[model samples]
Target: MENAKSKIKLGIYGIGLLMMGVIGISSSLSTIGAKFPEASQTMIQNLISIPCIVIIPTTIVVGKLMQTISKKNIALAGIIIFLIGGSAPAFMTSFTTILVMRGILGVGIGICQVVSTAIVADNFSGVEQQKVQGTLQASQMAGAAIMVFAGGWLTEVRWNYVFFVHLLAIISLILVAVMVPNTKPEKMTTTGDVQKTKLTSATWGWVIFMFILFISVQVYSISLSFLVTEKNLGTAADSGLGLAFFAIGGIIMGLLYGSLAKRTKNCAIAVGCLMLAVAYVVIAFAGSMIVCHIGSILVGMAVSAALPGIFINTGMSVDGFSAGMAISVVTCAQNFGQFCCPYIINPISASISGGRSVNFMCFIIGAVVAAALTILMLVWGVKKNRQVI
Candidate 1:
């Protein structure tokens, strides 16, 4: 407990939380606006997908940067760059250019996100490390939660102003680096450990888990903004409420999921991912605005519960270079989903809905993927008759 309360340690977790906020902010804005009202849902889906396309390779730089510099330095550079890239839209006139800027923003997010868990391990150890991870994740979720309100308030002022809110998190990053003490990275003991503990097929399973995991959660995020405009459900302000549900679902899961995992013998994760798949189906098929809203909460919960399972399991399975690389791979998958979903889902939903099927189709795909993965996993599990703890 004393370790958890360490002021220096909180600073480290603060960096991770702020990076998550930068990650969450982009999706919030993509969906919440009316300027793109005439765009097909397919176009929105493309919007999400496009940035992800850019992000996959950019993570190479994140890996290289972490190799040469302190993780704190890597994070600091990302925060500074994200602050600029994220805030750029407020002053820019063209939405097309805004898309370009978002891709740049993805680069920063991709790197920082890939390095987030490593930073915890880099700075803290044992129970302090675990506690810091929990808090950092909570902070990230809280950041997502607050972004809804942030988006609402900022969009109320000016849509572009939403970028400025990212600066607050950047400030948090600056504070953490300055306040936290610098320590040499733990020495790598053996090439043997690296070879022995590398990510295996099972580890890749979790990597896939994080990928679909983010999509399931982000489906609500990017969709919320557009769903409002499409359904003629209130104003842009209402969009934030959906994301609020997303964050709330995540927070609730993050808070209680560990206990749930303990009691259910980690059933929360298995159930959570399955719920994510179903939530996608619910979102895709939802007819009424209220139903969509309820679906959003479920999607959020699934995301929240499932992430811890993925993290804990993945962390146990992978180590050293393999861990770092796997972290990059999974995180890249997340941003890619965020980047791609807007592009893929938006247009599909807008189309199926008769005008902009992007939202509908995207969620359906997300749902389908989640469901498919779960079913295949179950088949594999049953065939092997294996039980996971």
Candidate 2:
């Protein structure tokens, strides 16, 4: 049957979405200090954060280019670059060269980020589209978990071996080539009643909301190390364990996202934010690594559930042609939040806590702010649901 065949094709196409999340193999380098003892701490930190700088501009540029080029081609090109930049450093000893390669890797990730989301919007519609959106976020969280958890062990062999994890991008490249449809951007019609792609104020609202939401959510990872050291909770390995729990939470949340969304009448995001607020409160008062691990799991669940809602809402808020551009804007905002969480949260936390136990104070502040936002979001959801009824 044609319908049965279409379902098979959709299943294959979905695999491409999973590949987007795997390139995050870079996050597993927290233990680089053991391998690069000669480098200063600041320079070592740059090795991780510097790639984020290139990811933003490169994402926005690729979003614009999709109009004039094949989306499949752009994604394929990005994967090649990602593979080269991500894996080449494994063979080199120079810190400077590795950093350069990481920057290039960031560019490749930036391109894929935009293309991956756009690919979903292009292929599916309605509820099916939303399900795929959630799956994509789940895949990303799983990918990060895989890289960080596995990369941690691989680092025990040699830090350079961790860089080889980027080679996984090759699998994604093949999926994109064979599974994703090779089609040009949608052509605009010249006749009357052609739907002009105009993003409404609602679309912009989602973008700003995502920016602020990401700013709050990403703080957990940015502040984790300090939280561990200031509290004398445990070793770097313990912190790594906390991250693994976070990923597990995300995977669980992603699996239940569809059913939760239906039961909540689309208030799933509000509920997820409330959970994040509670998790932060728990972390603020955590006295043991066990407590912190619990908090990390909650943080992961909250982020995983909340992000897909934003992506699905953003997709629905715009036309197909504008979806790429709109989604790109929000994606840029999300990355920008990752880039700025430390600079923004550190001073605020220090001033609030008078520099003693800054991480705890930041968590407390994050909890209060997220709680307030949750109330507003819940109220909005109730009203919208009522109108639909």
Candidate 3:
């Protein structure tokens, strides 16, 4: 029993490490751009953008494969692929080849992202699941923080050295291989022996909600630096500090989620949305760096609370067989929403504000939408809990 518990703990750490794969290159974009001065800014930015695009489709495919393949094997494969693709850019001279490698890295991250969450759903339930999910998210935030700092430091030595951040996946590979069990996909069994694979209406509802929520919340991330600089409230470094506050807030919320879960219960999602609404309002009117950082923390806390709440709710709404696909669908919706946000929000903000304070306008718009979502979520939660009672 003690040995099994140790494996479970190590497996969680392995899953957490997998999240570091997607964000390894985020801080290296400027360094990479300086190396390839011939390439357009947009083309250079595609190093990050392209991976997000690839992850959308890759996640869907991995979701389907989970039903047939051993999840441990798939996770190991993903780690190997992640290590190769993420690190290969360090050696290559051609920009096109590096972009191709990033796409390959996306495939690996897609697999790891889906598998990590699905594994949590497969192994744990109720409060235990919520705690694990919270830790998983905390891991992602922590990993991203580590990679950003490490990548920045490495870039000082050599632009290419930044890519070495991915080599950390080797630790994940070892832990997962030794500690994670080779579990087959679970089937939803009934007394009649019929396998129920279809996700219910409620589960689909949460998926759609998560998609929309992502669209609204992501406005803060994409606009923060622009907003801070435009207002003359801070420099790029200060904006970076504000974002650090954001990560700190997320880590705090994630660690507290289990305790919060007991009190909030079904109302957790609504509370998170409501926090977001207030955060956007605070951010929109900020006249100083301190206020901006405060709002950033709120944004991070709100998302941390809301996203895990969604995952826990989704897991409870679906059966074991459907959980993998359900999570995949939600993950796809999230990425899709993030992809669409700039396109969707940019135009609206531009038109409404006549391009004046467009970034600030995004926060105002987000505030309004988040307020609406809070009410909607509250109603849904009340109804759902009533049905359970």
Candidate 4:
């Protein structure tokens, strides 16, 4: 492929937009829920699931279609879907309509998530691939930081104004659609020496990792309009700033990730997961709502470091695996966690105490997850290094 442009630059701007679009979908709902006291937290969580429900099957269908379709065609399809999804607030009423639009948004995000990364990977090789991926992730965190904060503020002024975040993605899509080269897949691996891993390992690991990560996300990522109003966390805009801090933590983690990984390969991911687990517990056990915000920032940091590692590792592990599957499983797991948290809490609240009791459980579960991940990563790392059990 021609050295058409700097892959790092391409990745940052491309993913910055895609990530902005993806996070915008969730944040719009969540941030709106944050400002408005009318909706229940459980209901808000349910809305988050709307997109995930649609994305599971859509991912596979899109993956298969990627083989034949022009990247331009697929991306255009994704953007149109995004525009529809983004316009939901402008067009729809009632919670149900919001959910329907969210599902459409999910399809767009799912398609672009996989396809965009694949385009970068297709164009770049070796160290450049790693750098580009890292840059893309950092850009994503940066976008989330800005967009979520903006969403929160917009919710206060006028909720529909938040929809404009999707417009930001247009630059990324247009650039990628026109400027990025469509190179044929080479027969050889981009990074040398590492054996092409099997589909079985890749698929199984992707699913497992996705589920694990989302478990923590349940407590971390909240559409907690209930809590926001209940606790009086300044204003809706201030609330988004809190979320932005979390994303900023993630950006810091991503920027530092390459150095972290060089030490133990999966060092960043392993530690990231461990931190997430701890953060989840902290969030669950939080007495004041402020603790929840702290936990969110910590969780975002872990997610920033861990998720890209999982995607890269999965991409490397399975030669035939679709990027759509990679994006799908991770996102589905995330949304699953978001869905399950409230569902679990609803039933538990009735049985135990009210919401407070459930929060404690969230913390306890997070602790257990951290311990499990710490053990798993260390064991895996040791084995990879050929150290004895």
Candidate 5:
């Protein structure tokens, strides 16, 4: 029993490490921008977001592959790819080469991200499952916090050194290889019948919810530097501090998610959306670094609260056989929203302000949309609860 517990703990940690791959380059954005003066700002920003373009499709492929492949093996292979793609950019000379490598890193992230959540749904159920899911999110946020801080420090030495952060995947690779069991695909149910999997309407609802919510929240990461600099509030390095605070807020909310979910029950997403609205309002009007940091933290908390709620609902809405695919679909929606954030939000922000750059006005727009989402989530939650009753 003790041995099994240890393995479960290790598996959770491995998933956390895998999640660190998503934002590994976030802190390096400023340094990369300085290095490539010839590149357009949009192009420089793409270096951080280009991976999501790949992650979207890769997640779907990984979901299909999970039907026959051992998750442990997939995780190991993904980490190997993650290490290579994540670290290779440090040594590359060409901007195109770096962009390609970032996409390679996305493929790796796509593989493991689906597997990580599926493993939890496959092994646990009920409150225990909720607890583990919260832990999984907390661990991911904690790992991201550490990486953001470390990556920022590394950038002080050289722009390329930030890529070295990918080497940490080696530890995750070892953990998954040794500690995570090679659970076979659930081709057959316990009754010796072929298990059929299909996504329900509720599952699709959560997917859409996650996509819309992420579109608003992602502006925080993609626009932090611009918001700070445009206001003359701080330098590029200071944006890292705001990002760190964002992660710190996520870590706190993630740790509390199980309890929060229990208390909020059907209304969890509504509460999260409301929090997000308030957070954006705070950020939109900030005049000092301290206010900006508070806003960043609130944004983190809002996301942690809302996203895990979506993941947990999506996982519970499907059977064991469909868990991975359901998660992959939701993840694809989430990533697609993130990838389209600049395109969608920027145009609207530009039209409203008659400017091309994203600014505090973007956050104001986010706040208004988030407030509307809060009402939508409340109505949906009530309808869902009535159906359950």
Candidate 6:
């Protein structure tokens, strides 16, 4: 376990923090339908989900382009696009136009998100790599907490004010220009050192597993406002607090993720998934907003605990040259889940509760599915340990 330390600038490592801000940007917008009574429920949901929809293809394309384009340039380009797309909503009155802008914003998020991790894989190795990966998730969670918490207050003022959160991307752009090192894509070598990294069955397994995990997680993303409305918990601002609580959990777990890894080894992912399952169940049955906040915290911590492991394990699964592609594939699958979760779950939710709030149904189903997977992960860990013994 030789820990190869990377000499990449510290600030460059922080660039990934901005990507998490995207979550915060749209979290409060979950209540947009309330603001514009003319908008359909589907249209209201799209304002939040549209960025994720566009992120899928853009992430894949950027991952491939990383083979030829400089990571720094790609990141810079993403920031500019993000700034434009995030800010345009404030000026436009048309919902269609805003959706289009969100799509453009997704492009920036997709490109930068992939490149951020690729940069880490390219520069760092071993324990430092794991530490940085944890830091990346932690940063995103922290950013989400700040932005979501603030956006909640702003939402109370005016829904349009929430769009201003995208202004944070300008700061990220400046950091990239000043901090990220300029370099070309890694060249393939004839020495086999640069051999293309292919995704193993394990990689695909994890990718599919994450896709399912997110279907459950999106319940929170799309249903938080509704949860508040149906339950009489409070205002959309209060729902924003629920999202913030979720981010805070992630922030706490992400900061501790490296240490947690030291103790849990491969079991961390299993435990994290189980925690999420329980958290969703708690949310499903919550009697008060306080109880809902508890659930949000658990979900956040579970995500923070699980995702860094996935990112680190996936990045390490391949050679440095191919890590970008592998990570991108993993990211693409996750975003696809985010993009489609509402559509997939919403109808099922409608039927199960007869068009009442679907959060409870979605949470219940997510818990069952995640619980099953957690058992499998635990069993797999046990067998692997026995074989080693």
Leading candidate by TM-score:
5
Question: Using Cα atoms with residue i matched to residue i, what is each candidate's TM-score against the true structure?
Answer: 0.81, 0.86, 0.86, 0.82, 0.94, 0.92
**Candidate 2: tens digits of C-alpha lDDT, residues 285-384:** 9999899989988988898778777777787788777788888877877777666655676678778797568778778877876787799789988987
lDDT score, candidate 6, position 377:
71
Which portions of model 5 miss their true places by more than 4 Å? 189-196, 354-357, 385-389
For every candidate in turn, the CA RMSD to the true structure comes to 4.0, 3.3, 3.2, 4.6, 2.0, 2.7
lDDT of each: 0.62, 0.72, 0.77, 0.63, 0.80, 0.78
Clashes of each: 42, 0, 0, 1, 0, 0
Q: How well is each residue in 36-152 modelled by candidate 4, as lDDT tens digits?
A: 568776666655566655665665666556556655567667777876786665555566777777778878866776666666555555666666666677777777787777777
State the number of backbone clashes in model 3: 0
- Candidate 4's C-alpha runs over 4 A off are 1-12, 20-40, 183-198, 223-225, 281-294, 320-341, 344-364, 387-389
Best by lDDT: 5
Q: Which residue pairs come into collision in candidate 2?
A: none
Candidate 3, residue 21: lDDT: 56
Q: On residues 275-303, what C-alpha lDDT tens digit does candidate 3 reach at each position?
A: 89999999889999899889978877787
**Clash list (residue pairs), candidate 6:** none
What's the TM for model 1?
A: 0.81
Question: What's the residue-level lDDT of 89 in candidate 2?
Answer: 82
Candidate 2 versus the native: TM-score? 0.86
Q: Between candidates 3 and 6, name the one with more favorable TM-score.
A: 6
